[model samples]
Target: MIKVLLNGCSGKMGEVVVNASKNFPNIEIVAGIDKFPTEKYNFKVFKNTSDVDIYYDVLIDFSRPEALVDLLNFSVKNNKPIILCSTGYSDEDLKLIKEKSNIIPIFKSANMSLGINLINSLLKKIVPNLYENYDIEIIEKHHNQKVDSPSGTAILLADTIKNSLPIESKYVFGRDGFSKREKNEIGIHAVRGGSIVGEHDIIFAGSGEIIELSHTALSREVFAVGALKAAEYMADMFYPRIYNMEDLLGI
Candidate 1:
């Protein structure tokens, strides 16, 4: 079995992973690191990653942005590969992760769902052909308790579409004042409501016609399963580099 250390052990996603991982025959969660450590699972939980004394082949994180620095430090010092699934990282945090990749392999994604990653790949192909003639806009909705605005996944989708353009395209988060939509601006909007798992919609509006690409995440298991797959893939990666769901999916 591929022994794994799950971070954010007490969080909602962590609980989901704990329950979902049982079906995977080759993976076992040996320990967990959480700010609020509890005897909540069969394995031990530590408030700090450094305090963990058990053995684990890989690390999987679905925690907050605040835990990132310590996690990176511990992982690199111990030479453990990690799949980072947390969102809401600042620019400097991302820079630090990229730099650390030279010493320890890291698999990171804003969203872990395979459907979203597949949509990311499709946007690369879809953006180039229609961006010039179409005005792009994205609408994303999530549970009310989610901390970040215009979620990391929304940014990922927007960036994927923006990067596909030959020229620099501006990202407009939301519209308040009545202003004409610029040709080069891509609008991103976020909605927070009750009990919604995840929803993303991208519209390409032209003079006469409109096209929309959308995806809805109905359950948390999809992400848990994908993260487990990523964990297995990253378990044996000795090379120091960053990997993503696209790499695992070969898209």
Candidate 2:
């Protein structure tokens, strides 16, 4: 079995992961780390990485970006692989992740759902064929309690589309005071409402026709399942490098 040390154990996603782990008998969450650390779990919970004394094959984080440093430190110190599922990481934090990846295996993904990752792969293939004539826009919605705006998954999709475009395109978050939509602009909009698991829509508009691709996450279990799969994959990754869904799915 792959023993996992789950980060952000008290959070919503963490709870989802705990419940999802039951479906994967080979993956076991032996311990957890949470700032609050008040919730009762079947496994041991620690307030910080320093307080952890349990044995785990890998660390799976669904925590906040603020916990990145401590988590990375703990992973490196213990020579354990880590899977980072947190979003909204700053550029500096990304750099740090990449830096630490040179010493220990680090798996990171803004969104872990298989459908979302498949959409990312699809955009790479589909965007290049239509970007020249199609004006693109991305709409993403999440729960009100979500901390970040224009979620990491939204950015990931936008970045994928941008890379596939031949012409230089810039991102426009929202069109509040904008007079007109520029030809080389990719619009991104964020919507927050009540208890939305997640929703993403990618729109491509042309002279007379429009095309849309979308993915709706019915529940958080999709992500939890993917993260657990990542944990199982990372369990034996002794090499030092950064991995992602592409690596996990072999796409």
Candidate 3:
């Protein structure tokens, strides 16, 4: 079994990952690092990565941005692969992550759901066909407890669609005041509600017709399963590099 050090193993998504691990027999969470460690996991928990000395094949970080620095340090010191599944990072944070990728193999993706990534690739082809004739807007809904608005996945989707367009496009977040929709803009709107696992809708409005491409996640298992797959993939890799869902999917 590939031993994994699970970071942020006490939070909601962390709990989901723990529960979903049973389905992946090849991966085993040997340890966890969380601020609030609990006995719920069969493996031992550490308050910080620095304190742990276990032999883990990979480190799967679903923790907050604050924990990133320590996790990278731990990864570098141990020469281990890391699967980053966290969202909400600043430009500086991303730069730091990129720098750290030179030291260890890092797999990072805004959305770990394979369906979302497949849609991302599909949109690369789909956007070019429709961007000129239609106005596009994305609506993403998640649970209220989730931080970060206009989710990382929303940005990822928006960027994916923009890169595919022939002409330059601008991104517009939730608009409240009446402003005319511009032709060169893609609007992304986020909604927070009760216990919504995840939902994304890409709507294209044309002269007299409409088309919508959507994905709804009923459970967090999608992300958990994807992350586990990534960890196993990374553990087998020996080189220092950055990876994503596209790499994992060979797309």
Top candidate when judged by lDDT against the true structure: 2
TM-score of every prediction relative to native: 0.98, 0.98, 0.97
Alpha-carbon lDDT, every model: 0.93, 0.94, 0.91
Query: Which ten residues in a row are the worst by lDDT in model 3?
Result: 63-72
Residues 1-251, candidate 2: write the lDDT tens digits.
Answer: 98999999898899999999999989888999898884578888998888999999999999889999999999999999999999999999999999999999999999999999999999999998998788999999999999999999999999999999888989999889848999999999999999999999999999999999999999999999999999989999999999999999999
Error of 2 at 126 (Å): 0.9
Q: Write the per-residue lDDT of candidate 3 for residues 14-85, one digit (tens) a residue.
A: 998988888888989999999998998899999977789789899898878888888888889888899999
Candidate 1 lDDT by residue in tens digits, 73-142: 9999899998899899999999999999999999999999999999999999979999878999999999
Better of 2 and 3 by TM-score: 2
Q: After the best TM-score superposition of candidate 1, give how far the Cα of residue 68 lies from its true spot, in angstroms.
A: 0.6
Error of 1 at 213 (Å): 0.8
In order of lDDT, best first, we have 2, 1, 3
Q: What is the lDDT of residue 112 in candidate 1?
A: 95
Please state the error at residue 195 of candidate 1 in Å. 1.3
As for lDDT, the candidate ahead, 1 or 2, is 2
